[model samples]
Target: MQKFFKVYIPIVIALILTGCKEEVKKPADSPIKENEPSSIAVTTASILKEKPKNLAAPEGMVWIPGGELKQGAVPQDKMAMQHEKPAIDVLVDGFFMDITEVTNAQFKKFVAETGYITTAERAIDWEELKKQVPEGTEKPHDSVLQPGALTFKKTKTSVPNLYDFSQWWHWTIGADWRHPNGPDSSIEGKDDYPVVQISFEDALAYCEWAGRRLPTEAEWELAARAGKKGTTFFWGDDISVLQQRANTWEGEFPVTNTKTDGFELRAPVKSYSPNEYGLYDMAGNVWEWTSDWYNNNYYKEVNTTGEVQKNPQGATIPFTPNNPYAKEKVIKGGSFLCSASYCASYRVSARMGSSMDSSLEHTGFRTVATVAMLE
Candidate 1:
């Protein structure tokens, strides 16, 4: 699993070398024009053509006009890894997507309305353990069953090379969406935070209840790119002035988050500017779950299947090219915790996985759908 290489960095470097570089410069003044739709104020009316204000935010989908966009690394920068190799031409169809990640407030409403219990909210299934762990590996001691992971702060004095997730990810028993830390913790003040500890099934349930569905991996990526064809980021390639653009690691990775991005964990929904399509926080915030299986080679398979696949869910066989414990659903968009010192998956092609039974504070979700024809 450790041997599996991450493809984002190398691809980004390669793209920088060959692709037209756009300096990521922050404008001193607001760039919104009177005639143009404000990225922050996008309403459903904009996407669906004249709907109620309440319906505006829930436009629920965006049209990703299909076209030939550069699919992989062009120059193959040394930093570019092999998984994102063999750059190819691919296209995607228009789709509707949530304007923001499902917030704790929204997910709480789902639970309140349906009494739906998330997988992590329930006890671990003992029967399932038999399939993975050694026969006698004592049902994971209680100390190991705690909720939430320990986020370390790395400083000049602290070690930075550690990748052991267990050192941070503690399997706390009472840690679910409502209690991010454990039963002792609560969501009382964190209603605006992205709902975490959600399994793929949990996200699906919420989407189904809301008359929506999870976005395919392709749809998610297209949306994340926000109609900015061939750009490294939804806004542009320049990585500087990052504090104003997206929520990401400010200082050293796991250990020392300077909170320069105005956040330590997750931020309120719509806290950041939306991409060209009016999608907010698409780059960095929380790693969102998509409706796809884990497969390192999914992109290659997608290329072969079709150039403009409508819904490109990943292959069925569980496989994580980089992170092995991530053997369930695929996650996209690196979270606020992402850092160059550690994981640089904040890019468009980056991927992640979470067990159907497992959930974490860093994991959340958004929804998307095919564009609804004007009614």
Candidate 2:
């Protein structure tokens, strides 16, 4: 979903015109209480469950078997994040995962049943922020400026040079699961498209309603690998001929997309071939959410535990400096944004983070159901 909201010049303009241009500063939000003084004495080794068999997603997902496998980047691959470092041997219990992300039709069912309104669709409580804005500066009646995720373009700039994401992230008022592009855009014709603009809470709500849960970071990575013993991607290690497999950036990212993958926006679930495990679009399409809090030092911390972590979730603290949004959770599997020019995170080992409260067109989730009976 890289700039799907803005890759085309006309769409970008439309976003600005329809979007509110208010700059609401992130307040001193609640701390993620990861550092609870009363820590549980549980260890990863003690909570190990029996491994389950692999199977295909019933209708929405694929099966990921639990077993011992490499859990991080191969040695010499520097692209691995600090949290993805200290590659360790990890084992997982078998689980059923959505073959692809939850589609508009599938998610719509959950929303209809629960009547859940996602965070994206909710209007900002501007009244709460009235005192925060400068006294002299009045908010624009037509401009949008509350906190919201922006769609970025690949400008003629280096990766490190493109830090100013404010250029693309917008604060749309009516953007949500049903209206992905914004208030004006609807899911009427896009039932098969992956649902977007979903927050972590939004995803959790849907999973609960469906009797599923988001996968742990380890489980998500294992499933994305799709039983490719030593391959780099879910299909295979060699991404040299990636165009045939995943729907990633075929040309310049952010600025230009050749649409070699045959899609300028999101493709329908299972649009691509499945892996050995029968999982669809595991590498590209949308960045899937995991049930883990983010921490750059999480890997190092796990290694010292002397056993596997049980249904582990990430710490609530933001490990990066100046990134108040660091407290956000981890997401894996690169979106359509992956490219040699930037964001080469389409690999199975690649990882990224996003704020739990924030939503983006590129961000979505799949369900992981624990195997009821392990063989």
Candidate 3:
């Protein structure tokens, strides 16, 4: 479940070559940990009744009324992972969220206007890369250090196990959001599809340009739950309906994708029905970035009191045993790579940390606007 196989390019490249098998746990594989408060639960059950401002909803965004959210995996979720455990209620003020993951057309516009360059299009910085990896690690060859992003290359046949994800995820040169598959791929006719290969930094830049911001993990969950209660998925608990409801890896992952949803990869936004809040692609399509510093034990801090945390921003600094040096931010939703047999990250409570500078074929993002910002 460690999507950060590309978290630190140099480290991951070395690890993949040696078949590093250390288990990298995510929301789908980890067991719940005992309660240990890192800080006092200061924020408590609070709700914002009136909208922050009465401005009309921004175009292509919807209003998610502030409410009490049972954030994280509910007890009913048999497939829950540790990160989504200790489900805690959180309060978020009313905000406007993009109706879909930011589209290729949208990102293209931003680049054209601002002359913005995505992380994938930038050359690897050895100095920066080394900081995120262990000491004494040798720099990668100059040739392999070119600009690129992680692209999913499906294995022709089944592998021994699903744990080693490096078999399918490869670092491909020139695989930016514009060329999702690599140098050969282009987003030409797919303007409406959710843009992939977007790093956390790229998403933030886009948000600033658009006068919005990435949703907090809490806000993302609140919007994804879409007024639903006790449901494993944003749509509902029924796993059988996922194939029809979302564009997830419908077949054996890393080996075969049956294209059961008419999309072997990403589908255009709004291919499926929207959630109760009129949010599309909230449960799948691609993982969306949230503006929260990820800490594996942060949930315990908020859940200790069993009270709703108001607009809970995450950890002050990113820390996770899996990728200790990698600065990560919480990314929500799942992707087309998600599957029930493998990482069923499409569940509403499912969450994972992505290295801020890492970009992948299966990752993208959406933005949200506070009512105050709208005013």
Give the top-scoring candidate (lDDT). Answer: 3
Candidate 2: where is the Cα deviation over 4 Å?
Answer: 1-59, 76-78, 126-149, 152-160, 305-311, 314-318, 372-375
Model 2: number of backbone collisions: 18
Q: Score each candidate by Cα lDDT.
A: 0.60, 0.64, 0.78
lDDT of 3 by residue, 266-315 (tens): 89999999999899988778888899987777777766766657888977
Estimate, for each residue in 1-375, the C-alpha lDDT of model 1 and write its tens digit: 212122222211121111111112122232212212213221222232323333333454554444334444324122233344444443455555778888888998999999998877665454664455334544545444433322222344454334443334343556678887666778898787788877788999998898778876667776777666555566767767567778887786556789988988778877888888788888788888888786667656655743433334556687754334345676778788776655656667666655665566777899865545332
Error of 1 at 234 (Å): 1.2
Candidate order, lDDT descending = 3, 2, 1
Worst 10 contiguous positions by lDDT, candidate 2? 17-26
Q: Give the number of the best model, judged by TM-score.
A: 3
Please give the range of 10 consecutive residues that has the lowest summed lDDT in model 1. Answer: 14-23
For lDDT, candidate 1 versus 3, the one ahead is 3
**lDDT of candidate 2 vs native?**
0.64
> Cα RMSD to native, each candidate?
10.4, 8.8, 4.5
Per-residue CA lDDT of model 2 for 1-375, tens digit only, reads: 123233233222223322211112222233222212223344335433444335334565555666555666654343444456555556676677777788899998888888898876565555643443334444444345443443433455433433334444554556677767676777898888888878889999998888888988888877777665545577765667677788887775556789988887678887888778777878788888888776667677776875645444555454533343234577888778677655667777777666666677778888888765323
